[model samples]
Target chain A: MKRLTLALMVLMLSACVSVEYVTPYDPVIDNGIREYKESINTLAKNLGDQAGTEAGTYEANLAHYNALESKIDLLIERANLQSAGRGCRLAEGISAQLAKVAPEPMIQTEEGDSYGCTERLLVLVKDQLDLLQNIHQSADKCNAMASPRGTKISCLRATTSKAAMKITNQSINAVWVVETAKKNGDNG
Target chain B: MSVNFEQVLANILDSAASAFGDGWDSIKTYAPAEFKKISSQIVEIAENVAKYQLNDNEGYSAQTGKLLLQMQRNATEGVLVAVSTLTLIAVQNAINAIFASLRETFNDALGAIL
Candidate 1:
């Protein structure tokens, strides 16, 4: 058991740098995992404490959606953004795409873990992931987001380039898994 | 009084030594009573896990946080006992002491009920 845990840890350490969603190596994009779990807990707590209705639900749902939007601030810490020129572009793209999403009702949940809340939260997660997928695809085509830190110029000229797309893909996949953890936790 | 609870606690401490890590040996000298008490708690919680799981998963779940919370709530008393003479390495050592103590308490309470 310890060996498996150690092996998993090693694999995750390496894969975390690589950027795959289901790598079994990475532990859900370090910061991303922590933030996502917090958001889920917050959303669930709100739902449980609040009344049942669209307005009540939206107020709770907005809390999570707002968190997703704020994640763009993470890019500021990445040195690659300054030289790549794609940083601003990537940020704008993410903003524009995510803007369309609103909390909606989840039909049925197959998430890996417990539903932990009403269908309302599930739909919100799924919708944001759908938008994130699009943003990732758009970014991947440019390849601008991929440069290692401290680089003056990178392979991709645009901020939302293909490399940035990869991060988007990873973010989406991570969010999707948590969103559907009830499905993955049980059925997957 | 009866000696069953202390023995129950000792058995659990043996089990808890695994989770408490190597530092426990040194930790024991400072607050032998508290250490023994905490070890017993670990055993108690494990015992409860079996009983509670068999009866009601939710009930078992509720106790999970309570064990730790109760320890924190009574930190002044139990902590004094646990750290009677030990030189602490870090704040986490105290947390570890509490965790060990709580787990024992949980196990004991659960075991009696079961």
Candidate 2:
């Protein structure tokens, strides 16, 4: 009887020690992710429209679009993980996306002959910034409903999203100035 | 004379930042404690706007100015909601007045060069 009681206690302890993983479901986040993907696709289409037929510019713009698409894919993967309660991974993915999308300085040409592609690119960047802000706001709402780990990830997402918007805003401003100067010189 | 776009942009940004700071100071004093925590965030938003280098193009300048006004309104609403004492609509008139004054100030400063 003593041995049987000890065995029953061990079984109870084992049951208590076992952990079960449960995926979290948030409709708002799911909708936001879907919207985000749609927006990226729209921007990609816009970029393609603005990409001129010139071989070099076409190739360059195509590469940039490809990079953006790949980042979107990664973000979707991270969102899937986030749905599974993998918050840290989502945060890392967001940070990585921000770093990847951060704009580089535009190459200045003496003739300033970009065929208006630069202006279109700046518009695309601005749209992306707006989307990041939307994502950040959605994540903030999710943070309130999420577990501690999810909150940490959401916090990271919110912070990185703002940072990305700021960086992209600066890029847009710089490009606008450059484009304006070129136009002014041409007009004069 | 060649217009120095950078100088004009810097002046505009500086003026806007100063005006925003003053407006924020007033709001902070009147706002409840919970709203005060967002002071830094407001400043950061102002700084982000100040970082932009705008052109003298009337259309572009107008668009940017409008966007800035919208941002100011959004920030005001955010602050008002933080207090939880007043609905956004109740304070909408007051906030709109403040933003109008700020916009006027920005326009006056920008109009001289832009």
Leading candidate by TM-score = 2
Identify the runs in model 2 with alpha carbons over 4 angstroms from their true place. Answer: A1-113, A130-142, A145-158, A183-188, B1-114
Query: Comparing only chain A of model 2 with the true chain A, what is the TM-score?
Result: 0.27
Candidate 2 residue lDDT tens string, A28-51: 433433454455445434433332
Q: Per candidate, chain B TM-score?
A: 0.33, 0.27
Question: Which pairs, if any, clash in model 2?
Answer: none
| Candidate 2 whole-model C-alpha lDDT, 0 to 1 | 0.35
Docking class of 1: incorrect
Error of 2 at B80 (Å): 42
Q: Model 1: runs farther than 4 Å from truth?
A: A1-29, A48-55, A60-64, A72-188, B1-114
Q: How high is the CA lDDT of each candidate model? A: 0.33, 0.35
What lDDT score is found at residue A20 in candidate 2?
Answer: 13
TM-score of predicted model 2? 0.21
RMSD of 2: 27.7
Q: Give the range of the ten consecutive residues with the poorest summed lDDT in model 1 chain A.
A: A153-162
> What are the per-residue Cα lDDT tens digits for candidate 1 across A63-127?
45566545533422221222232211111221232232213212212332111221122223333
